[model samples]
Target: MPTIRKKGEGQYHVQIRKRGYPTQTKTFTKEVDAKRWATIIESEMERGVFVSRTEAEATLVKDVLQRFASEVLPTKRSEQSDKSRIKTLIEEFGNYRLASLNSTQIAKFRDQRLKVVGPQSVIHEINLLNRVLKTASMDWGIALPGGLPTEQVRKPIKPRGRDRRVAELEIAKILEATESLELRTIVTLAVETGMRRNEIASLVWDEIDLKNQTAHLPKTKTDVPRTVPLSRAAVKALNAFGVKEDGRVFALQAESMSQAFERACEPHRANIVGARFHDLRHEATSRLFEKGLNVMEVAAITGHKTLDMLKRYTHLRAEDLAKKIG
Candidate 1:
């Protein structure tokens, strides 16, 4: 049973108590509404499906996201990227109360986001939102409207894998435009070894073994340490760039390097409209295949966990294959 008392100004306070459950309380503007809520809550308790909605109803999405950003994001490996996506979510739904969050609203957000960004970006954002809601429901004891709304929302189609190999002429233009020796060397290493830009930029001198012709990465995006066998070109680039015994290989930040690459690509933008710094990885992977290396061999170099992932990067041209056929 719920104890109902009239608080001044037509407000009624109701508190429901049951065995083996914490007392739940709420204030209603109407006495009838108070009685109605108590009946529903007591019945739910009897059926063992009751959840306290006080926190969820009182807290806004902005507060939950802020708390997540401060407490949870810092512990993540992809913290920078996670923070960026969480910030975007906050900007969109910060004012919404947690209790009011629902599938229809989330679907509207997804549809709207798809107009401006790619499907992958929207997917990442929605996934984070789902994570936050789950945490609130399970850990914070916040009652959600139902199961995660992300399940009901339609996700955009996954985009096709990019196969934009850098053409010789485009490569020439990029190299020519790249006056910085550091950026030049990074670009060369990416094409020659098929290593990601961050992997190349973050390399330390100790990770490189010029004598053994291998670079040992202690950590990579795949969360595995992979020793990339250095090609003759890779070794030559490393030698020309020079190395210190126990320091970073390149004195560059990943974002700055990416920006520099983008600027270098500007001159040949008309020819390479969709080219990105990452396309160099694709180019290098395809080149490895052209050199007659099998899928397993390429996977070893690229640190692809599976052959399916490696195949996405390997885009061999028909003309090249036709010549080999003849």
Candidate 2:
């Protein structure tokens, strides 16, 4: 049975209760509208098609983002990136009710986002929104209409893989220009081991086995543990730097290292205009292939989860390959 009560100012409040389903209540301006909703809800409940929208209807986009950040992101290796994207989503759509969001509105938001940020950035943001909505529907019992709006909108094209490899002379200049010994060692490690900046920054002494010439990475961007085989150069760098008893190998923040690296490269800004620190990994991977390492062998050292990903980092220079051909 559905109960309807008239509230002040031509308003009617309807509350519906079914045996198995949870209680649902809503306020409508007209009694007829309230009655229609009640009838539909009651019918759905009787047919066992009722899904509780109470939480979804009441929850704002911002609140759901907060919940995801707290409940889910903590367990992810990509937590920081996910949280950053979640924050962007909340800033854009925080006030919108989860139940009221539709593809049209989300598409409009995507258009607006495209105006300001690059395609890759907007794509990442949309990806995060879709994941949140997916979790809400599957895990939280929230009934959002029309599914993920991101599915309806035209996604941006995937950016082409970067093929920027640092040159040997440029590498020498960068090595000489770095302000700190730790930054120099860190740069060397990236070039020698093909480790990502965060991986190198987060590396600890326990992860390194100088005797065995391997470094145990307990967590990587792929959320997998991999043992990176240390090159003779990498081992020599570690030995010269001296091992810490048990802390991070380099007390370096990834962002700080990036800033420092950019500063070091500033003097050669014209020559290496678009080169990034990550290009060191590309250079390193290409060097491994040039050394006659097979795809699988290179992937093992690079911790690339797949050969497809490893390929992105193996852009050898034509001149370098030509020398080998001769």
Candidate 3:
């Protein structure tokens, strides 16, 4: 049923030839191991459940990651970030064969990465690795005999969400400190509409409908298009700049806006402790809740896919709640 021959010192080669199936061959260090492998392959063939793992055994993780980076990563909304992660993965796992990847190796990688990076970063890397493996298996027809290793590895615990909210005094200080009218306007929009820094930075005149009091975002972090209802404050801020039919609302890029905000807050760090530009979105969401907007209503405006995520961005003040209760 199978042929076993000694190729060299400590090298035993086994070949299995089935009438209905393709020939399977492997080389092992010991004759016993070679025989055992042949028996397993023969049993699977007899049971009609045999699937060749030849390609998977031969392919390296580096090659798959390279292919994925070229073909799949470009199409993703987070292509740049994904490319960075893929590069890291290739550096770590490039030498290992696809079939050799296992839960033990993945668990070790998770633990090792946790030492250098935060849990969330490790989680993202592990999730990306899983995505790459699944793509290899499902799309590329690579059959992993050991299954996906990431499925069995225990993921690190996610850190608690940030509850930072900017106070009215701090907001005023930040605005007053910044001489740039454009940065001041961006800050105002962030707090009023709960729009992310990127969304606000990438905004165009055409996306805004002053008559309807709405800003249409065709591209968002969630890749879901949403129309943010504009407050009178938001509208007035936009009106401060003369309206054009179509063009970028602000000249600043996302990174530049963040850097400018950081610079603006540098002088008042004592008062604006731990406050980031993203905190403006949290402030806006909390205000919406205070205004009696329901969960669904706030989610629609903020483009949050889940209530849990929306809750993370909303931090209502005790004094405000007490006033409402009274």
Candidate 4:
């Protein structure tokens, strides 16, 4: 039914030739292991359910990831972040063959990553891995006999969303600490319009319509275009810069803005506690709710794709809520 021969020292080669199925061959260190593999292949062939594992068995996880990076990563909005995750995945499971990848291995990776990073970060990495495997099977024509291992693995529990709202006094201290007009303006816009740091940093003068009280965002984190309603205060802040119809609204890039914010917050660490620049967004979202804006109205202004995400950014004060109820 099959042929097994000693190819070299500690090398046993097995070949199976079925009448209706294609020839299959593999090499193992032991004779018994080679025989066991042959039996499985022959049995699959007998049942007319044999799918060649040669390609999947031969391909490495890193090889597929590299291909995905070159071909697919460019088309994605989160290309930069995805690239980082891909690098980590390759570092961890690069040498493993696709056929050898299992749920246990993925589960171990989840547990290991949770030690160094938060659940959300690990979730992104695992989801990326799952996407790569699916692409390998569907687009690259690599067949996985056992289906996707990632599908069987349980993802780490997502942690609760941050509810850190920036207080008025802390905001005042931050604005006073940073004399940079650009940084002050960025902070002001973040609280006024609930615009993300990147969105504010990347905004050009043409995107703003002061007369119409709106700012059109051509690109956002969700890859969706949004028009944000500007308050009177937001308009006044923009007017402070004067007319520059062609350039970015802010002088700093996203990372530079974050660094500058951190530096500004250094002196007021005790007063601010855990206040991050992003808390301005939370503060803005909560204020919108406190002003009697409905869910749809707030979502439209904030560019939040889901009510759940919008809720994460909103942390209304109970005292204010009680006033409304009374």
Candidate 5:
């Protein structure tokens, strides 16, 4: 028998006893809520599908944490990335019973998450959760029903890449503003090598081989290992550091670098004309084409995996193309 008592404030005290399951009592804010809970418990008990909160709590935390601890942390991903992503999932979807989190709930969750975080980040977090949920369903049998993201969610469109080649005069102004030797090295490396910001920040001495004129980048944004051939400008920029042994070449914060790159280009923005630092990759590829290199050679230089990926960087203004045709 289950006992219900009025506990003030329209609340109820619920107590239930069964032979196999221990006696449980809890206070609820509303009588209807209590009744709803009791009904679920009684029905689950009849079916032998009841799980006590105390017994299942540890499994939920462990199930979520194992992915971060084992799969994410061991990889060369950015330091805060794994923690940030896992925190988002746990904060939003944490309290629900793992067994009850289903396709409809996940869809609602996807919409809720997209409102706050970028749609792209929502997609990423959903993908991460799917991994955890899938493992729980298949490996541990913890009761997640299907893959999250049964349908593709739209990602926010990042603006078209500005591939403006910094003109020789504008490059001069940027070089002048880059007074700090470190900033100079970073800017020079970015323009010369076309390395992404994270790749540049995470660069290590072990990855460099000045003797062979190449850098064996162990990890990249694309998760593909690539060896960037050292350009003469890159070599000159590195020399400014002088007698470099080991440790990070540019320890500049990723955010700070982008800020400074923006500031340095402020005066010459009209000349370079709506190009971000990443556009340097496109600019670098344009330089390759101007120098008469073929498509295969340009792909080798830029580390683009496919011709389609390569084309995204190749936005040729009609004037520039006209000059080439002329």
Candidate 6:
């Protein structure tokens, strides 16, 4: 049976049903909208079609996480990172219904999250939330219970465009500061491999192949495996680091390593111009191009997915560019 009734004010209630199908009902404020709904329902049912919006909205965030755990996690090169991000989503928004998420709440959430984490981090968390909702709506065909207009909720940018590289001499100063043999290896590998401090600290011994001159960088910022050639400097440094009987590389936490590097460069921080440990990557890529390696070779070593990202890292010297032309 199909029921048509008056709802509050201008609203009309319409429920369309047929045997062997779930009932579909919707509220409309206009007779034209009701007629449109009725026509679409009748036309679709005549063609023997069905979909469920209510059941989809009823599903939990944990259930939605299954998509990430099953489809996304295994393929991710950085298992540790996937676990961490998933944990954040689970802790912060696990109980909230995907369909019921809205921009007003999301904005407040971003603002509050920024107080605890950095603006960069809050932006990242919001991006994660957006991804989850997109999957729920597009992949599962679930109607939004309270849809988000994400732009309205975003905080003002906190001025984040950093491209830092260690100057040759300061790089020397940092090396001397970290006199510990282990710390030296940490600094050496970072300079040569241009790996993020976290990725370098996360390196497990089993992934390194000395004979093949390749170290399998399974953990990275981009969550992709990057095979770094064992430059002689990097090899010498690692060998000096000596092997830990265990699988891990550094005994220290990743943050600890970054802190050590930061302390080493404290003298230059007065005018560092947005220098960060990760900017070693930009430095390494620049040096490679300076030494005459082509873009393709640089991309292979840096694990950049596109020339666009690679360009961001590639800062050719004026002399180097002239050499190419001249």
Worst 10 residues of 3 by lDDT: 266-275
> Looking at candidate 6, what is the lDDT of residue 13?
94
TM-score-based ranking, best first?
Answer: 3, 4, 2, 1, 6, 5
Which regions in candidate 2 have their CA more than 4 angstroms from the true location?
1-26, 31-50, 268-272, 306-308, 319-326
Q: Residues 1-326, candidate 2, lDDT per residue (tens digit)?
A: 99999989989999997787778899999988999999988888888877666777889988878988999999888899888888888888899998778778778878898898888888888888888888888888777745676688788876788988888888888878766788778888999899988889889998899989999888888888889988888898888888878988887798888877888888554244667888889999999999999988888888898777887788977887789789
TM-score for each of the candidates: 0.82, 0.83, 0.92, 0.86, 0.67, 0.70
Clashing pairs in model 4, backbone N/Cα/C closer than 3 A: none
Colliding pairs, model 3? none
Instruction: Sum up the clashes in candidate 3.
Output: 0
The Cα local distance difference test for each model comes to 0.86, 0.84, 0.90, 0.89, 0.68, 0.72
Model 1, CA-based lDDT: 0.86
lDDT of 5 by residue, 1-326 (tens): 67889977777999887789877677788888888878877777788876664333335544554555566555645436756777777776676656455567667777787678776677677766766666555565454322334234444454454556666666666778666677778777777776777778877877887777777777786678888877887877777676367887777877787777777767544234455667666666676776677889777667788987778777656787798899
Residue clash pairs of candidate 2: none
How high a TM-score does candidate 5 get?
0.67
Candidate 5 contains a number of clashing pairs equal to 0
- Candidate 1: C-alpha RMSD to true structure equals 3.4
Report the poorest 10 consecutive residues by lDDT, candidate 1. Answer: 265-274
Candidate 1: stretches off by over 4 Å: 3-5, 137-145, 168-173, 176-178, 222-225, 262-274, 289-300, 303-311, 319-326
lDDT for each residue of candidate 3 in 1-326, tens digit (9 for 90 to 100): 99999997999999999999999999999898998989989999999988888998999999999999999987776788888898889888999999888999889888998999999999999999999999999999998887899999999999998888898888998888888889889999999999998889879998999999999998888889999999998899888866788999999998899888888888554345677988899999999999999999999999999988998889999998999899
- Model 1 C-alpha lDDT per residue in residues 248-320, reported as the tens digit of each score: 9888888788888888877554244667899999999999999998888888899999877888888899999
Runs in model 4 with CA error above 4 Å?
1-31, 38-51, 268-271
Model 2 lDDT at residue 151: 83
Model 4, 1-326: lDDT tens digits are: 99999987999989899787778889999998998898888888889888889999999999999999999999877899999999999999999999999999999999999999999999999999999999999998999877899999999888998898888888888888887878777888899999988888879988889999999999888889999999998888888856587877778988898788888888554245677888889999999998889999999889999988997888989999888899
